[model samples]
Target chain A: GAGVSQSPSNKVTEKGKDVELRCDPISGHTALYWYRQSLGQGLEFLIYFQGNSAPDKSGLPSDRFSAERTGGSVSTLTIQRTQQEDSAVYLCASSPRASSGSNEQFFGPGTRLTVL
Target chain B: SQQGEEDPQALSIQEGENATMNCSYKTSINNLQWYRQNSGRGLVHLILIRSNEREKHSGRLRVTLDTSKKSSSLLITASRAADTASYFCARRYSGAGSYQLTFGKGTKLSVIP
Candidate 1:
């Protein structure tokens, strides 16, 4: 079975530029999540999508950060006006469902973004 | 802000020795999951312990959860060099009929061969 996967394993952009990171979740996964891992820091939750319900954007750091999952599968995270502070590895994970006891997110290889 | 804090930041042990990592989190959680990451790659799920459960074991890995203290510890016995990696504890919480996870900074473990 295919696990979660991200595209453009690495990306480099200039400050004030915009970059989009893509994620393909596992088949039949009803829940997807995005997180950011900065240098020497923990994984920070970004956004979440479950089935057809409204996505949870509470973890998004700023208005420049946004994401959308289409057809309950693929998701794209867009960072507008990229800053050096946004340089980090963006990770995507998916799960069968979003229940307390059964949810175990499968992570992707992640896309490392560098803003200069 | 992150919800959990991992102690010792890093650990190094002999191949035949055991490795232990501890985590402390704020607020209540429904479950705590342990994950291993190698070389900054994707994380692999190791074990999950529910709040009601005090301890759980998986192969050479043993996990103990103390809700009273909001802390958890992971022990890997007879660790091999292959086990060297970053270990993280993710806290799961449910709100508004949805579940979310918050991860700790992680402990970097180095198993010497």
Candidate 2:
């Protein structure tokens, strides 16, 4: 079986534009997570989706950052009116279950977004 | 355990030498894990240690967890140039916000060949 996969390996956009990153979690995975990494901010959690439970948006830096996991498999992270600070590598990961981090997560290659 | 930053944010070591990275978090956790990242891309999980466990070993990698001290350490024995990468420690908080792992700042290891 294939591991997690993300689309648009690289994206460069002008500031104030919108962008959407996609992720395809492994089949049967019940938990999905999104994280961002930047030189200034380090690693920051963005959002999480578990089974049918309401997705946890606590880690989202701002309302401009939003994500959706449709059919409990594919996920999309949308940044509205992106800022320069939004330039970073966006990573996606998935787990077999929502074991509260007890289960190991498989990560995707990531989508590198550069906002100019 | 404190979840702020990893000690010696950057380290350079000889290929044959060993490398140790430490992480401390202030919050209670159910488990801890270490991951390796190359080129600042996706992370590869190295190991995981549960709260009830004290130590874990995988090949040349050894992990120690001290719940009482709220700290964890990752030791790579007899490192190689290929071992060069940024290592991060992510802890699973016990209660609220346990859905996601809180990652540390990470230690960048440069193994000199």
Candidate 3:
């Protein structure tokens, strides 16, 4: 019954530092996704994980952005050598897996990261 | 990088009024979805309409899709102050390996009480 949850609601880090955002998907959800929202970029997709299949990282802006889902439940998005441009709200979402195309994702509160 | 664009970047309306936002996309899509974000936080799913369907409704929310013009519109009738938020339209293309979603810049709506 619980929705997706994100940790470290707010994170402030200096340039070149590294930060990791965590996401806990809803129970029985097999599809997870990560996105970033900023004034300049609006909202953009970052990564996607479905079942035990390989994660989709094509949306990641750069090599510094990476994510992994362990046990197909919890996911962590890591940004290395953070830059000021990385400042944005990181959001996570999860949806049930079905072929009918009616799976609507439920989102988390998100983690706001400010890179100085 | 973005598939669609929303008109009237910002809008203000009195409570009980209707708010309509339009989204125009560049390419074909399997489905289109509307989401609402409050205070720039995580988004809440509102509704989804397939490309084949002309219109769909959920409570006070009405979504219309025009595949011929590659556009969609979301209308919230009898809006309340609680509906103040940023609304986005997302497009999911017709492909398996392409799991990415193309989102519009969004329309900021303020419902005044």
Candidate 4:
């Protein structure tokens, strides 16, 4: 009965550093997604993983953003060489059904990343 | 690029009063979903209306979709103070390989008790 969970509710790091944000999806959920929200930018999709297939990274802003879902359960989003503009709330979500249906995603408490 | 716009940007209403939010998208979609965010944290899905569905209701929430106009409306009847939060509308593009949901800028609703 647990919902999606994320680690490090808040993170503060200097520019040029790297940070990793973790996400634990609900049990039996095969779809996982990462998104970030910042002032003026709204919510931007980062990456998505479905089942064992390839992950969709189209929405990733740059090469610095990367995510991997292991065993189709947990996912980690890593931001390399974090820039000041990367400061935002990183959110994770999971859907019970993988794809091809009316997917309603359940979100987790986001990790607020601040680059100074 | 299928992102939409939510009207009013911000709205304040007294408890027990009805609240309405409008959204407009830029592309064909399979379905549209509404979500509520508290303290800018996780988004709690409110409801989903498919392209084929003209309207749907859940509890005090009523959602209507107009695929022809690529717009939708979410109306909350008898809103409560607890309903004060940021609401967003996300749409799932209609086609394969497009599983991502496009989100709007969101509408901030303040329910004054």
Candidate 1, residues B1-113: lDDT per residue as tens digits?
Answer: 43878887999999999999999987887889999988787889999998899999999999999999999999999999999999999988545533888899999999999
- lDDT of candidate 2 vs native? 0.89
Per-residue lDDT of B6-111 in model 4, one digit per residue for the tens?
Answer: 9879999999999999999987888899999998999999999998999999999999999888899999999999999999999998887557788999999999
**For model 4, how does the per-residue alpha-carbon lDDT over A6-102 read when each residue is reduced to its tens digit?**
9999999999999999999999989899999996446898888999989989889999989998898989999999999999999999997756577
After superposing candidate 1 on the true structure, give the runs of residues whose Cα lies further than 4 Å from its correct spot.
Answer: B94-98
Off by over 4 Å in 2: B1-4
Candidate 1: what lDDT? 0.91
Question: Model 3's CAPRI class?
Answer: medium
Q: What is the RMSD, in Å, between candidate 1 and the native fold over all Cα?
A: 1.3
Give per-residue lDDT, candidate 2, residue B8. Answer: 71
Query: Tens digits of per-residue lDDT for model 3 on B1-113?
Result: 43778877999999999999999988778888999989989889999998789999999999999998888999999999999999998887776754556788899999999
Residue A104's lDDT within candidate 3 is 75
Per-model TM-score, in order, reads: 0.96, 0.96, 0.95, 0.96
Q: Model 3: how far is B101 from its true place, Å?
A: 2.5
lDDT of 3 by residue, A1-116 (tens): 89999999999999999999999999999999999999634578888899999888888999999999999999999999999999999999998872348657788999999999
- Model 2 chain A, TM-score vs. native: 0.94
* Of candidates 4 and 3, the better by TM-score: 4
| Model 2 chain B: worst 10 consecutive residues (lDDT sum) | B1-10
> Candidate 3, DockQ to 2 decimals?
0.63
Superposition TM-score, candidate 4 onto the true structure: 0.96
Q: Total backbone clashes of model 1?
A: 0
